[model samples]
Target: KLRERLKISGDYHECNETNSSLLLLTENNTSLDLNISRDAVFGNCLDLAVKKFQKRHGLVVDGVVGGGTQRALNMTIEEKIDKVQLNIDRIKWLPREKNERYVIVNVPEFMLHYVEDGEIKQQLAVIVGDRKHPTPIFSENISYIVLNPYWKVPEGIVRREVIPAMVKNPNYLKKQGLEAHQTWDENSPRVDTSWIYWEEYLYGQKKFPYRLMQPPGPKNALGKIKFKFPNKFSVYLHDTPTKHLFKKRVRAFSHGCVRLSQPTDFLKTISTFNPKINMKKATKRLKGKRKQFIKVKNQLRIHLVYLTVGINKEGQVEFRNDIYNYDKYQKRRIR
Candidate 1:
């Protein structure tokens, strides 16, 4: 009954040389084939079945059975069934309130959905954390938006990246628009590099108590805007200066934060949540090196979720690659 209900498109046709591969793949497989004959021909039933399978697994649903669809097809019947069941459980655990608007970042899919009243209002491509620093999954409320924000270098990054670069080239920090401060506080004093003990911090001989921040500019890592949310993981959504990364099919380049492709468009949607925000005036503030923070009157709910499989609007199954190997890890626990 589950397979019968999936909406299928395309007309039935007799098996031809071109469809021989699709025929052998989709036919005689009880998991995907809904009683289709094992003839070496492409027909209406086979086309529908392939489309249904593609949609259910989050494929392009082109009914062409390309490389991605072929990979999905290669999964055994038991594995496919297991994936569906696992995702169904995930659905059951989802937030059930229908009236509330929210944002969802599907990690595996590399996409973000701005949902309002159970419908998608805006959709954008997002770059998530890479394999080394896989994006942590959690829920939080967006508290504010920062214009011309400063990029505070995390400790891990400072140790692994900034320190080494500085050791090789003393002027590296200045060239990169980074400034060293005495402390991490808002009113902390900036420090001149010449007077600081760089060697001690480099060799771990002494604790690095100072903070490194990249001020707002065209070359800034965080681009021009940043969306702040309340989360223990210190992960939030922001714009990226490396615009070419968004063009890639798989965008897992961040250290641990979500990078927005359409931050300005997202800002427009954010304006609706707070009466104090006038997007026209806010756009003017985003210019230059001045840092400005705008707190929202009503916070928006945001969810950073991990789902490799889902059912799309067409009621077809959709699937994505488990980039972090999270599915393998989770399934082991279930077993």
Candidate 2:
């Protein structure tokens, strides 16, 4: 009960009750070979074991039992059992996949697996939505790939961010690589800003009737390309301008859409599946800043899923924090 008395603060060669509990917890894992002293010391062996344990559990391998690491260590057996049972029940609820080629994006895991001929052909890291704007779970076929796609800023974003920014500076649109069109159509001529009182919209006296569109380029929110799977929620997989986020251990930051870490690599993989795709031309178009939409002749399905427990590379069972707290409502049931 040393670990029960207190969580390990973390350091090498420290002899304390916390270290004793930490060692006990690490010893129980059995997956890693600590081989260090079990004599209530946070020795080098225990540090190595802690790193391995953190790596195995998808925690940041800092060798320190920080808040995140402590949370993982503190997970009760009953809670883990509930998660396993919930996932077991969840499997039955999933509609059987009919396609031989499909993509599965497990929301909680923040990972995408491309399966072909019953084998996992490719896997890609992805950044999904946080609790506020949780990613929706649904299945849809990706019909086309849009290169240098324009981002039609959502109405909510326009209302909250764009409108407020524009109220202060009318030139905000031009500065952000955005254009205010008279209509939703791209070809619609740019409206004269001076004529309309932009402040009326800020005051909620008049409905903001202009559509904002960001042109295809490096500044595009959708990045260089996007895999489209049309749905009511308008959610799809796409590249992001901020590529650095993928480096972090925890990557649940997006506005409901799934962000791809290796979008170009995934695109190349897709190119192999469809012979009609011209990778050379796609690359050229990207560099030339010319937008192109390529049709995917081969059928491809994208399933956005919710799972908190999954197997790691070594076939070891791993648990993920339910950031969305979906486990609370997803009561396990059997028919």
Candidate 3:
């Protein structure tokens, strides 16, 4: 009965009516030796039993039994039934269909996957947000991509980081390629660089009377390409000039935006599968000085997701480091 409920097919290796009956008996943590005589049901073919058990539960398929495989096999029929059922439910939580292609960002594992025709074509390590600044999960269409975009300093960033730094050294903004702008109305307090020494303002001893913005260049925080999507959060995926940062296995060093290790490779991959546009020309265009904006020929769906447990190509369930603590939230939701 457990075998039927598990949907274990007769086509599986070493499976039979007799073993099927044993499955029901041993399904609830009951132990049975493979050496049992052929006359006995659910006995013999220990190797085949282990392999089948592993295959069904998304474990490494080694005929030789191990602790993990043993633990899984020993699970009661109800427990085994629930494991499969839960994964099925999890699958439902994912996007079922897409318009031919999409980019998938699994936040928990800190990886990005490109999927086409319901199969993962390419995967790359990604730096997600830390616990304090966890990456948000959402789906959006990639409308257009910007090349060498300018970094617009947000208000919070100016007040928290820039203003204090400027007070210490008048040349701080100059070294960082920042320019000051004064545009407040008459009612607003005036800030005069001539009166308030920049050195004092950098140390928080005085306040600078201006807005600062760093221009676009190699030193600019945003390296090159930036994928644009309409969202309230004003967040977008982009390349970073600090390419060395991607070398680290756990790259969670960003203010808020998602940073890619190999953004050029990603762009090539996305453009290749896209029905319109020549990927070769696009690659060539990036070399030019002029910034380019290419609208996706066919709107591609991009899903920013999080999953601590996932299956690999070998069908083995792999666990990744939970950088964002999303697993606890998911587990709680499931419970």
Leading candidate by lDDT: 2
lDDT against true structure, model 3:
0.63
**Model 1: per-residue Cα lDDT over 1-335, one tens digit each:** 22221213232223343533345555445545466776623566766776776656656665665666656766776886787777777767877655378999999899999999788999999999999998998888888999999899898898878887888888899889888888876469998886765777885656788899988898789999999997888899999999998777678999989999999999999898777988888788886678988897778888888888876776656678888987887788898
In candidate 2, residue 289 scores what lDDT? 67
Model 3 is weakest, by summed lDDT over 10 consecutive residues, at 28-37
Q: How much does each candidate deviate from the true structure in C-alpha RMSD? A: 6.4, 3.4, 11.2
lDDT of 2: 0.79
lDDT at 262 for candidate 1? 91
lDDT of each: 0.79, 0.79, 0.63
**Candidates 1 and 2: which is better by TM-score?**
2
The list of candidate 2 runs beyond 4 A from truth reads 1-4, 7-44, 168-171, 194-196, 203-205, 332-335
TM-score of 1: 0.80
Q: Report the C-alpha lDDT of model 2 over 123-162, residue by residue, as the tens digit.
A: 9989999788899998898889999888998887888788
Per-residue C-alpha lDDT of model 3 across residues 254-325, encoded as one tens digit per residue: 766788878888777767756565667766766763567778766668888765557667665444445665
Better of 2 and 3 by lDDT: 2
Question: Candidate 3: which stretches are off by over 4 Å?
Answer: 1-91, 181-212, 273-285, 330-335
